[model samples]
Target: MRMKDKVCVVTGGSSGIGEAIARLFAKEGGQVAVVDVDEANGQRVVDAIRSQGSEAILVRADVADEAEASQALLGVTQHFGKVDVLVNNAGVSAVGDVAACTPTDWDRVMRVNVRGVYLMSHFAVPIMRQQGSGTIINMSSTIAVIGLQARAAYAASKGAVLALTRAMAADHSHENIRVAAILPGTVYTPFVEGYLKRHYADDMEGAVETLKRRQLNQELMTPEDVAYAALYLASDEARFALGTALIIDGGVSAAKVF
Candidate 1:
């Protein structure tokens, strides 16, 4: 019941980490808003949450678009009366070193991963300020702190999110607004599975094993693992954790395997 009666808006909530967060929040007694561009899956998640006797609504939106982002927030506040938690979890990834990453690909990644956070926070902050309390969780990545093989664009975008989280905390913590970032490492989401299929079509198992090796536990992290971290941050228990980059990376950024 950590999130009891809290109004949570989870972007990208149709699947993966975002969906996990939405469901967990609802199970904890929070009224949830599932925001995503995939209307079908979004509706499915909302229906399932309701079937379990939890409150949830699907707000279809592409977080990268300012108009859509603003409308999405408006829809949530209209339905829920206020936003107690805003999870900026929607993001896109690109694979390449700087030279290999095209300008178009770089912009696309920035739009969803960086600008999406900015737009969502821009709208959510004022609402929270008026409410006199709220929590904002931005989804960063371990790649933001350490270099990865071919994640130049993604790394850059997440790093921006981390920086923005700190800046936001500095600006709003005194106002009872908590802004924090979650740095998760290689969660086994559909997005990652798709990446594996595209690049390692003939050796999916090997690719997955390689991913596990990067973590100290030698096991892939799950979306639920990250959702739990978000749950902590969004709950009142984390009130003292302002501007925190809660790392749930299974020790990936803490040490080298060698």
Candidate 2:
């Protein structure tokens, strides 16, 4: 058990990559807190973990809200005593170029993807500092480093996350707090499925194939893949991996597909 007796908090843990991370952490012996705004799905994940005879709890929170973020962390502490790992996995996306994006839409993206990370970390860090050790794994994207069509706001938010991760690592390393970000490529999550259905209504299959081809391996990255990377970053095994942008993008960033 890599995380035996540790307490881990995973935001947006109701579905997709977040749920995968919560489950994996529990299986590895962490007392997991599945935090999300969806009560039904969050409880479902918690129930599943308990059914498997592992420890887990559900925390309902809107990560972009500072008050809610603080309360969520408080809930975790009240139940599990302290936080050993914090995974900021909650995020929302926007589809538009800079000119096409309205100010409101841009703010929404920043609130969830960038501000959410800050809120979670701001509250969780004090607890970690008190304990003299902690780990933070942020969910970034391949688009943060590479240009992607119709994702200007998303790219900006995730790029901020990468910078935030490094800045936090530098600020807190002396206190034994490790901070890092995971850059995943196009993953096959419910969100992606819906996105494909909406944007590629007439040619969903073709669009999916086009996306797959963009990856050198020609396959969509799974939620589990990113979850496993989160697990490594949260565990003692990745003690030396602080401030790193760990890329799991199937070589997309390295290859030129033109």
Candidate 3:
């Protein structure tokens, strides 16, 4: 019960890493607000958490939408009374390098990955400040430090997240709001699957092999691995840690694959 009686909000909570985080948080006795634009999936998460005898509510929202971001947080606070942790995990990624990526795609990534974080924090920070204790966990990527040839949009967006995490930590340290980001490498989510499908297609299996071969570790990281990382940072145990770029890259970020 590390988070017993805490109120947590997880963006992109419908599936993948976000879903994993929400479930884990609930298991630790936190009341979770699962926010996502997909009502069906979001409700499924809420029901699943509830079935486990944990408290949860589903808030359907597009993380990229400012109005929706505000409404969702307000709705959560009104329901739960206060926020103890915010996990800014919603993001969209497009495949294309700087040379091939369009301005629209770039803007889309920024709006969701970067601006959405700001919007959520804008509403969440005040609540946390009043409470005198809060944690913000932003999801970044290993690509922020590495050159992922065709994922310029994602890299740029995550890079911004890393930067923003640091800036927010500095701004709110005195207010007792701790900000941190995680950089996960090569997570096998629908986001990565889509990239493989579109980019590799017939050669997808081979691409996966290549990716594994590139990994120093034998296994591809799961959403739970990242979820545990989130749990650690969101806990009271990690209160002294701030503005940290917690890397869960499994040594991929440590060596040169090329």
> How many steric clashes does model 1 contain?
0
lDDT of 2 by residue, 93-156 (tens): 9899999999999999999999999999999999999999999999999888999989899999
Writing each residue's lDDT as its tens digit, candidate 1 over 85-187 gives 9999999999999999999999999999999999999999999999999999999998889888889999999999999999999999999999999999999
For model 1, the run of ten residues with the poorest summed lDDT: 249-258
The TM-score of candidate 3 is 0.96
| Model 2: worst 10 consecutive residues (lDDT sum) | 249-258
- Decide which is better by TM-score, 1 or 3: 1
Poorly placed runs, candidate 1 (over 4 Å): none
Q: Order of all candidates by lDDT, from best down to worst?
A: 1, 2, 3
Q: Write out the backbone clash pairs for model 3.
A: none
CA displacement after TM-score superposition, residue 197 of candidate 3 (Å): 2.1
What TM-score does prediction 1 earn? 0.98
Best by lDDT: 1
Once superposed on the true structure, which residue ranges of model 2 sit more than 4 Å away at CA? none
Instruction: Report the poorest 10 consecutive residues by lDDT, candidate 3.
Output: 210-219
Q: Kindly list the per-residue Cα lDDT of model 3 for residues 172-250, writing each as its tens digit.
A: 9899999999999887777778878987999988888877776778577788999999999999999887999999977
